[model samples]
Target: GTLLTSLTEELPINLKQLDNVEKTKTALTPVFTQFQQVLEQVIAEGKFTALPLTITVEGIENYLEYRKIDFALGKQTFFSDWLPKAFIQNTAQFETVTNLSSSEVAQRIENLGSGEIKLLSVRVDSRNIVMRYSR
Candidate 1:
């Protein structure tokens, strides 16, 4: 079944938006990890169907100006500005994305850490991206 969904979550990453404010890896997780770690706040929105899940991050304490993700269908029109060049070069699956089983992700996460997850819970429903963490 084909579902249609369009939602705008433009609220800042403040206490009001995130009820249980804690260590969250928003859509900007990779951006934060690969680029700037000083940003404590940002904004995020995904078109649900867009293959690459467009993520936009604006001024967080005026660190950087406008940045946008251009993805239409099953391909990213352009690599994220801050996306490490090594990432693009080292990307094993460039032509397509491989879906990893939950157990696979869990096992890999466990291997990377001492049985802890970055995003404890991640799911999509009613055209929304929901997440939770172990607090």
Candidate 2:
């Protein structure tokens, strides 16, 4: 609860009130790609089981769904449009690569180290975007 509260409070005013209709999935592609790239690096070095492949983006949270993947290679991962939209939405995650900017995402990716977190799918419901992850 505390974390969620902090996340809400820290949300950018511009995006907090912004309507999802005006947002474009293309706008989020770069941020998601950056995250994917990070995981891919881990997989290439044998740090993670495989590179995260599957990804989905939505406008609402309720539409988000999770699936079990028995893939021959790669991990699973997910991300939302909020914090990323507010910070790295149009920026480069590898550029800063620290907490100086997007602390939440930076910390999450940093913790993964050389491991790939597969994002099974993403559901963008009316409230928030939910990302699915798997080993």
Candidate 3:
């Protein structure tokens, strides 16, 4: 009860008052800061264990979902429109490298004649690439 009252006082804006995406985005920083400060205070005063504390803020999920949509739309717009224009404007600084033929690569390796060649085993998974070097 005391913590709730302290959080209520520390928060700049009431969570219930944020009706739109813009308001929620604007309040996100302050709300997060207040919650973090309150949690830190509680931990510092030895009221709760910091290691396994799970503080759930109601209605924050809605704001996070809206923000996620906003982020995706912004990313799409940036990649589709702004990035192309920027690349076109800076074309001189960017160079396109042609793919080398397998024979050409083999010839280059042959030219390096009798040197120790290290082989690498690569494994590609959905989330990561694991590469192991073999002598």
Candidate 4:
């Protein structure tokens, strides 16, 4: 496996947005493992030389500032219940803007929570670039 200098990808939503917060949070066993697998896969195969790869968020927190809500990549050997809390805490003021389709917005929300939201299309991100999911 080669040492990866950089990797780009979307950050998953928080786990608190689930309808049944406790149950959903408790049921995150598989998701955490999947996340770990993704990381391992990258480490095992990727060899990015870019100092900082650009990762665009496709959800409410498109600017990547909301990542703080997510568990630190290297922390939490068992990341079973941080996703929802992170989402609720971060994208609290999500508003749809131009350049993003309604379907895209809906997809993002869908990725975040198990419920539904009207409009379903709120894309934010103008000239300023926001790097998301950095370790």
Candidate 5:
């Protein structure tokens, strides 16, 4: 949270780069290429289809990077509108949002209490998820 707040304020932050990125790239390149090929084929079919692929990465959460991937399904789907609209509606419920003051947020961070705790300000606009903390 502190790192996020610092970023909002344009303050310098200390971050450690993940080592051996080249190694990871070299290992995953072939798999990624194959995956791309599969997606291209599926897209070319132009059918109401769902493709499932599972990916796992190590030590990414601790890397202090914020990443969001959003794609519109309407452009790719054979049917018009309904699937994409439903998809957008379903995901809006999962955004972590909070209205607490920054001091209360700081206390939550300080305590690091057990079990599930979410303190954030999230906005979902046009099906795109934007997350901000103390900005």
Candidate 6:
């Protein structure tokens, strides 16, 4: 069986036109209830020892700003402490090679023998050229 499992829950809130916190909370209450129910069922089942959960609330920045929720203690801390610590496990996989020319980058890619090579990022000065290679 695969180790990773993805679950996406779409909340009924327009990210572009966000309302007050109370309204947002009210809108999310049902989805949160569903999540709670699923979690409770999982707990009752006794299927796994440790379950790593990652919740990605899209457009949360706008909502946070709209709600005037100040993260006095940095974003990373807020995410790890407040949200879920499991997120910390999701480390960046791409490798960044700085100060490389376009031809150098091409050469590097060509050298990486017969695998899927993804060009994550590329800049003019080649300051932060990120690449990910997988076999």
Most lDDT-accurate candidate: 6
lDDT of 4 by residue, 1-135 (tens): 123234344334354556776666556656676767767765443322212211123244443444332322213222111222224422332221223333433344334432222222334333212222322
lDDT tens digits by residue: candidate 1, 16-128: 54655453447445555543322221112222222322121111122111111112212332221113111122111112112333344333323433222222324433222
Which residue pairs collide, candidate 1?
A: none
- Compose the digit string of candidate 6's lDDT tens values, residues 1-135: 112333577767788546578778877788778777776765454322322222221122233331221232123211222222211222222222123343454445445343222222232233222232221
- What is the per-residue lDDT of model 5 for residues 1-135, given as tens digits with 9 covering 90 to 100? 111111112212222322566655655566677666666664564322422111111122321221221122112222222221111321321222223333333344334332322224343232233322221
- For model 1, the superposed segments whose C-alpha errors exceed 4 Å read 1-50, 54-117, 125-128
lDDT of 2 by residue, 1-135 (tens): 001111112222256445664454444556667667766765554434321222222222221211121121113132311122221232111111111223333334335533433433234322232344443
TM-score: model 5 vs. ground truth:
0.23
lDDT, residue 47, model 2? 38
TM-score of each: 0.18, 0.24, 0.24, 0.21, 0.23, 0.29
Rank by lDDT, highest first.
6, 4, 3, 2, 5, 1
Specify the poorest-scoring 10-residue window by lDDT in model 6. 72-81
Error of 4 at 94 (Å): 40
* Candidate 2 runs further than 4 Å off: 1-13, 16-18, 21-24, 50-135
Number of the candidate with higher TM-score, 2 or 6: 6
Quote model 1's TM-score.
0.18
lDDT, candidate 5, equals 0.29
Give the best candidate by TM-score.
Answer: 6
lDDT per residue (tens digit) for residues 4-62 in model 3: 43444344457676776776777677777888887887666544421111111112224
**Better structure of 2 and 4 per TM-score:** 2
What 10-residue stretch in candidate 3 is worst by lDDT?
Answer: 89-98
Cα error, residue 9 of model 6, in Å, equals: 4.9
Q: Model 1, 116: alpha-carbon shift in Å?
A: 8.4
